[model samples]
Target: MRKLALNDEILLKIEKPARYIGNEVNSVMKDKNEVDIRFAMCFPDVYEIGMSNLGMAILYDMFNKREDVWCERLFSPWTDLDKIMREKKIPLFALESQEPVRDFDFLGITLGYEMCYTNVLQLLDLSQIPFLAKERGEEFPLVIGGGACAYNPEPLAEFFDLFYIGEGETAYDALFDAYIANKKAGGTKKDFLLKAAQIPGIYVPAFYDVTYQEDGTIASFTPNQPEAPSKVEKQLVMDMDRDYNFLEAPVVPFIKATQDRVTLEIQRGCIRGCRFCQAGMIYRPTRERDIEDLKEAARIMLKNTGHEEISLSSLSSSDYSELKELVNFLIDEFRDKAVNISLPSLRIDAFALDVMSKVQDVKKSSLTFAPEAGSQRLRNVINKGLTEEDILHGAGQAFEGGWNRVKLYFMLGLPTETEEDMKGIAHLAEKIAERYYEIPKDKRNGKVQINVSTSFFVPKPFTPFQWAPMFREEEFIEKAKIVKNEIRSQLNQRSIRYSWHEPDVTVLEGFLARGDRRSSKVILKAYEKGALYDAWSESFRYDIWKEAFAETGVDMEFYTLRERDTDEILPWDFIDAGVSKEFLIREWKQAKAETVTPNCRQRCSGCGAKRYGGGVCHEGQN
Candidate 1:
């Protein structure tokens, strides 16, 4: 019998014992004694939240497919179980094997967002692992970070031994083989790290030394070790249909998960180059999975998991050339089985409205639109490529389709945003409400509920807006008030609801998103001062972060408030994200000129993903 860290008594006391239990339907079970590498894949969030992550699921399934690797799932315990485990001195364990994560050969934590820095620390502390990467020895698990946040890994460099930049599918096979060979040769941890740094996508922060100018800007960042490359190019899996594993039998959770359904990734990357979107820029040159493959994956996953619904996952679902075909196929195939198809990240076009009408309940469901900016001019500035006319037309179509509720997403504190632009958000919402009223009273399904939400935009690395300056908390709030006041003054006040994200969290995210190696001290200090689950508004302590910044002598304003010159070197400059800096700089200039550039599909802007000779560029040549 495998030894469980949590006993029966402890498990019984926790709210969801299923979260800690090892066995779940379709969860990979391997003989630890047989495998050479024990990989514990973790998402530094609650079980429900982590289980919903498709990337984690794909990686877990991929790793387990290797004969010599025993890969198991791990997630940060909820407060209830967390308290009991810490008090009882029970080390954190993987869900499949119920073995302590400390004993695992590799601990891969996916850093999808900046807010999870504290939770990463909590995971380490609970696992009885050293908080800092430097403090651990050969006996300790090699901590690796990946995902979107790993693109800008400076704020987290001190904690993770190495960061795997870019797509997970491209580099892991080489990584595992190297690890197994090193283990056989009885290599030291330093030796393994040096070898790991030799891999194309692997970035070992300790091998790089960063010097700062008197003004706290990065003066120079040079590689110390000969093995470590000066520039770590992000790995891109070009052939999605061939290389990508559409996870066939994802582990079915016994309890409810955030996304309690089979998720089929229809595509990777986005064609629309929204300037503020980090995902769009980082995941360059759009690639769509074959429709036949998607159908098979969807069928197998749903059948294995016995899920009631299946979601088509992608950055932009509507942009997928075969979206209609895929969605229709899913509906036709799963209709008899009573499996609903969830199509998110869609443009509110006529086709989308028609498809949505079939799958969703018109009364209960709310149609979501990410206008990104409130005004057309501002939309052009951000390269959103969405017009005000598109919003009204889409809303009208939805109203006609018997959808009453509409959720509109916008970003506050965008570069060069005016008070008029803020009011435009309300104007757009009000127009949507009016469109609802335009429908004949007898023809209408229900009352209109337009929810307008704004989040403060934090400039991210590898984006045209990377040099954009973030507003102070007060400025963000004041701008939000401009929209709120305009909404309240509208005739559709009752139908429209206005809400904005917490400015404090936005400020913190801005700091972390663009911070350098020096900013890692602030994160460490904040975690030491009891910062966990900073993503949750209720759990965030701004004062603690403030104190950490002060103590570390790191100014948050230096990261958030200052706009960089076009020629200045950024913290993430070394990581070649495939999207050229020259292209981004050009786009930035276009934004300033209020000139809209067409997407990759329309015309090649020469973003340098073409150099990879894949995705849209390859197809364009054909």
Candidate 2:
């Protein structure tokens, strides 16, 4: 490990110096002579935010459980600290020992989202490692990636040596044990990677060769090495509760984080089966932790952190079968402690509303609903399964229950969307506003505030709409304009506020989400042109991305705005996510025909979960 001369003056000059400092409680430290394998668990973001993530904490705890293995945390420094490090010539260091990241045997980065692509390259360069995998030789640490983004890692494949798809609880340990055995035999990095590639769920990009046809579609992806598997199967833990819960005692940050309170996951997947939702598909076979387990985790977390609020996190909290009982338990447990319990993803239903009323005082709380589409027909096409009456009835209940402010979430550019469907958004908002006025003037609050936030729909892998074309930026903006104008002209009231996400940004995201290995060049080039934090609206640069696409001779529109054939080979075809391609095709056909698939918990649609030998997931079972 290269050590830089410590300059106290410069350290004091940067913001959040604690981020650069390497000492924290509960951090692992093992002697170089004692440990056989050194792993750096990296989150491609800053310290305060990364430390709070449950995935990082779980892997950190799991890897450290092995006496022969030592794992440390690494995160991308903020722009202010990055400036200082560049000026001071300091390499990226681990948060535990202050050692450079290059010294570790494996640099395991968790890819949480597409926006963090540029940050990965920034961290690699800051660590003094070659940004591209091909440029790095035997001396470099093996680079691996995991997390939700690993499901579709084609766009960033060139940077990572391998990708651990799906759940990492079991696969990570299996790979580490293999690495430890290989390293003890004095094996080379390539030799160990070859051996690791043989393990299920580990995808080694170097062993695979990608060829594109004249039309820019993938022609073939062949494995050059015999040890590599022809196809990689994603890893899934059979039991989540028996696994690790590392969020019980989170690392308190010196500065405020994006979400400062404790978060307890009530469930793992969604049962609604929204076609446009990547999370819904990626996290299949909706699994809910036991209510008793959740309550205990919350109690322990609150006792340890003294946090004033707790967020019940999941793809959809309302779908949890025991949601009412869980919320009641939490409210009773924390009511005297003055800790407010928050449920973020609530559906528009009476049962969900009843649960909310039990935990929160309606007068003091704000409600949020994600109808997703404006009209019933559009909702059916997306498999949202939400009726127009559900929205109106839910809004009326909110107004009658004394909640004055409600936030509604919708999407603009869905597959097979029409102008009439876009106008229905305004109609829904106006109906909600009228519902608010129907309440007695004395019972009504000062004013009812309706906030409608719309975002462009982006096609994602492993979904029914994977072959669908995203609406062009101009088309999406025109639709947004229609929705905006209709809302303003109909409501004529400042109480209703309408906002839409930028369409160009969504187009770029679509390009990255479904891109192949060749797209890494565009990402690195864009990063070189100063594109970091594309997820944040303030830091997004459309021009830089366009320039990068142009220099690489890559047509962004071809990837984002072109409809694909059902028989076309997808970049993620080699990855088996437990859901069959036939099922996805069936769902796509059902979506186009406006047929709603029943929730799996209610009835099995033969989606292949039973093949794993587990019946439909329920409350008590793992």
TM-score top scorer = 1
Q: Estimate each model's TM-score.
A: 0.98, 0.95
Per-candidate Cα RMSD to the true structure, in Å, reads: 1.2, 2.5
lDDT of 2 by residue, 1-622 (tens): 5243345786677777767665554466677678887888899887777866877777887788788888888888888878877877888878776788898888989888888899999889889999888889878889999998898888988898899987777677778888888877988888888998988899998998888898888899889999988889887765767763445666556556677788887777677788998888777777678788888889888887667889988888887879888888888887888888778888867776777777786466778878888899999999887888888899898788778898989998898889999998988888888899988899898798989999999888999999999878999889999998889877535777999999888998899889998788899999999988787788788999989999988888888889988888789998988778898899999988988888776666766655554325533233
Global CA lDDT of candidate 1, please? 0.90
Worst 10 residues of 1 by lDDT: 613-622
lDDT of each: 0.90, 0.82
Off by over 4 Å in 1: 362-364
lDDT of 1 by residue, 1-622 (tens): 7677778888788898888786889998988899999999999988899999989999999998999998999998887887888778989999888888999999999999999988998999999999889999888999999999999999889889999999999999999888888889998988888999999999999999998888888889999999999999999888987899768999989899999998989888888899999999888878888888888888788778899998889999998889888888877887788888898899989999889888875354999999988889999999998898998999899888888988999999999899999999999998899999999999898689999999999999999999999999999999999999999999989999989999999999999999888888898899888888999878899999999988988889988999999888899999999999999999999999999999888898999888877788788632
